[model samples]
Target: MNGTATHRTVIIVGSGPTGLLLAGDLATAGVPVTLLEKRSHDISNLSRAFGVHARTLEQLDARGLADQLLATGDTITGLRAFDRLTLDLTTLESRFPFMLITPQYEVERLLERRAREAGVDFAYESEVVGLRQDADGVELEVRGADGTVAVRRAAYVVGADGHHSAVRREIGLDFPGVSVIKSLFLADVRLAERPEDVLTVNGAGDCFAMIASFGDGWYRVMGWDRHHEVADDVPIDLDEVKDVARRALGSDYGMHDARWLSRFHSDERQAPRYRVGRVFLAGDAAHIHSPAGGQGMNTGLQDAANLSWKLAAAVQGWAPDGLLDTYETERHPVGKAVLRSSGGLVRLARAQSPALRAVRALVSAVGNTVGPARRKALGQISGIGYRYPALRGAHRLTGTRVPDVALAGGRLHEALRGGRFVLITPDPQAYEDPGTRKDRLTVECWASGRRTTVLVRPDGYVAWAADAPDATAIEEAVAAAVG
Candidate 1:
């Protein structure tokens, strides 16, 4: 039951969205990447996620996938949270100001296609049974669909497997967290009557529920019953979903013809470390939280975006010292923040007592009326407000997300398509010979004629920015960042 060992520059232990993106980025950057997945070929998870947020859309746009994915779904500009607060995404500064309501499988299909085009070597039905990492490389014992065991060695391995990650288990990392909700029901059903809103959710009585379009005739519905607690193994019927929807969402919308149904629990957990030696974790393998904010998949995609370039740099031998460590440092805090925010949304939806309900209403009042509070909430939910930790004496813009601004050639996102560090300046001649890595850097001028010159990372965060372009400083910034 054993086969010979094989080697790859980087091995990814899952083919989910996160793993696919990371593998694609690495492969596109001319690094050898192999992806291992336990699932069979052509299998889809029935699309657990429906709403792709604005920030994630921007990430997709950078890879030339946003428009194609947008065609497969509908869009919503405002998101209703806990029934009272509506976060308006139309005011967001990115090119994508609204969330796309599509099945998760659409995203997977697109990402997988891109990954394939980028030359990612994929081994389907190859499950990671065990993982061990040393100083030089990581070793993975994989089991194929035929039950034959093989060993895969890689300079680095990323586990984007999921909440029940074999890589995390093999590595002995603690995923300490509590179950935020139990007996949660999710289903895809045909709704004879369409809801007024693109996304419908409510926290009424003992039920918390949400329903959104899958862009076809079916609607994706999710509900949790506070009074009727049951184990996940118990089968859920359409009538049960109808009852919950009636109570929580006010009406079932004449929902019929259940295509798929399941019951599960949501856990709020984050790994203490995203990286251990040469092994890394992304997506659900690193964090999981309530789906209240529609951030489960979005956050995972962002994690891949943040980690992929750093990984590419490391494998290509140009990454600055300790650049790999920033993956955990930058993302762990975001994961923790997501857990808190999504957990808070779940708790607010589950509030049963009069005092808690009043507090919820007060929060709603403030969030709806207060400008700063609303913007902050929108920022958190949309994933646009987050900024990485800035270096000492760095410019205020450093680590902040660079909005999709127009360049002399095209949009900023277009310039980032090849995963190169972008240096935007008013005077290109100032840094004509800045001694930066020419292959890894793309120089562009602002179409709006701005004076400041900014170095943007491949993942679309500001690495360094200067009010006025200085050749020495620009050279130093490029050398320090895009080495």
Candidate 2:
């Protein structure tokens, strides 16, 4: 307990996808970030998540990382669920309209690389055992590999740890929710005869199974048995997994050579508050739910993206009042919605009663027949429907994610890689000189006949937009957003 205490700009606990992305973004913006992780530096081959949706791909594209990640994964233009409903991504309004199917480890690997390139200091083999925050900053008590305890102080602390987060516990936050399903088995193995579909999922009366290839020879299989209510530590037999798959999928596809296998229970839980003073919770530390729609890791990554810019603004001394608090106000609802949607999917898939199954079939038929309904459902699951609340009197485009527009320079997302707000105005003379706020804002003219002036946040959300030039409103909005 005698090790020296050190101070950092931000201390991020847990080096998962959320933590890594946040660290990379903050560090890229010149905020000093220290990442503390309990796991070793070695990357794991086994992965629980394998799909990245369109909105997430756009976020990655803003950082110039989508293509790199896309190269490692396969893509699916449509997804079928419940044996009747099909959600097509081809009609999505984005450069990447398909879901990228790759192991979660691939994502972590890319984010880790980005974080390292941004000069984020990683303290592996360090676990945060306690946290205390005052008016100015937070103090973390960390236990290192050799049993040495040290205090690390930071202006802010973010808990990106998994469900059992020490940081969340240290702050006395209650993770309130219940387990939705138990006795789910996860396995990665070789498929003797691969399915033609990019991802295949089905649920029978009492069981459900999903299989997706990693683009490699191995395929991931997840299934649940209604009768097997055993503890997580109980050994899983391949025969049992195949049995469940056969029951739910009607065939096991000659699965063999199990590389990894385990059992876990999915819970629908959310923290009462994402922020308690200067300590904030994100990713699984804030919310978790059933993996029915493959939304868990994608939701966490989006949370990191939403928070990184605000934290950077704070660290760099330009954040406006209440800007930091918006993190919880904006994201908590999204987290809760994800929990509900995923839970609903799980309940529908696990329904054993004949009447419930009939209801599922009816709903699927409606979803398939109704175009608007299918698009809405697809948007929700794919995250394209997410929109923040705009400021009162702001333009209608405010709070909406700006599409990747073609500009004179290049694509809209490509211009955002510099980590600065982009002001797109048809009238170049409508705004003040960029020289004054060059550190935080960039002025660009629309290449086409776009008469509207839009102020886009670093995260690609339209902060303020106007049909015509409003110099005074632009100045005031800029001040309120950046300072």
Candidate 3:
């Protein structure tokens, strides 16, 4: 193949959940997004990460894919501890209270479909070889099928590629973190044991086990075995993996017909900052951690959602450059917390000493007994624990995820689906002035049955809200955000 050239508003590297979701959002925002995937074929059955938390579900629901996901996925109430202790996450009270357990491949497929519907262009069998940032945009060198080379230019480039991201490398972002000491094995198999009372994480001598029930007769299981060394030259044996499972559970669990098997070494690395000039990194490119709480894929999806609107704002020229910097300010801390918590979780699970096991049992029992402790643990696993410091003021709901409130005509989420800053005010007259509408600023009038007005960003966080009657104050906050 020969050289070719193309142009797009945004060029997204990778076709994983993060890249596809951002492509869909940007396309929906009227930005032409070129999504390049190194893979030629559509991946239909990969099963790496499976847990989609409530917060992630809410984000997908806003994109109209929640119903499709819920249809094919298993709904888990909450995580279970060592033995009979079930956390009962149904008590969390999200419209999507339960964790949706679907494979990563399924989620990516759903996102690709949505992105296609939104008219996002996909360049498959294409690998990003090199990229350079210019004063105006980014120029990319891509290798396509048949060894054809092409040059593509875009206003912005997003690196949603995995841990070894070319985009991140091209921008020279340092990913600093330590790797785990122990290796863990994950397998999808049919278990002879009946469906358990909860997803189990057992603490046994020299090992720890985590298992989740999946669709069909298959169950996804992970465990650490000191005696087992992963060999890349040899395929994982079902019998060998079964032996590890039995030892980890301290019992002979009948496991058969292993579907997928692999070993993983954990890394708690993250890019020091998410944005590097006109190029940005999201998902695994920005952060990678142990799959302790099943937050890997969900965290990446949220990262894409957060970054997409900012890219859209930049393309439209309504967003200040400072507004884009807020992505790192808000998401970097979340990534760090994820790394810390995931590392702590792995350490806790792998503590093998008799005294350490006893201490862990006592702590788990005590924490389960207390409401605040239970809520805190649930929040950590579910990702509802994040609160950005940038949002501050009189708004009763500032710095919080905007609730899916019911308005006169529809859900509040409907008004925000188009990727624009929405100003919700009791009196529309204040923001209705023609001057505010000149710069692609969208103002919607809603009677919240209160004197206050709420301004929400495209990522579903409240920028500001007014508790008092003065429209002037609320207008100021909205004006600043929209500006």
lDDT of each: 0.88, 0.88, 0.78
**What TM-score would each prediction reach against the true structure?**
0.97, 0.96, 0.90
Q: What is the lDDT of residue 372 in candidate 3?
A: 83
Error of 1 at 331 (Å): 0.3
TM-score, prediction 1: 0.97
**Residues 133-246 of candidate 2: C-alpha lDDT, one tens digit per residue:** 998899999999999999889889999999999999999999999989977889998988888787888888678899998898889999988988788999997899899989
- What residue pairs clash in candidate 1, if any at all? none
**lDDT tens per residue, model 3, 1-483:** 112233338999988999999999998987888899898866856467878998888888777778888877788786766543457788775677788877777788899888999988888998889998877889889999989889889889999999999999989888999886446777888878754533656766666776666676677887767655454345566776666667666543578888788777778899987888789999999999988788888899989988898888788777764888888888888888888877776766666788877766775887679888788777777877576775434445777787666655576667666667777766667665457544344576664676567778887787887755475775567667776
- Model 1, range 217-294, lDDT digits (tens) per residue? 878999888888889899889999999999987899999999899999989999989998888889999999998879
RMSD to native for every prediction?
A: 2.2, 2.1, 3.1
Give the lowest summed-lDDT range of ten residues in model 2.
Answer: 1-10
Worst 10 residues of 3 by lDDT: 1-10
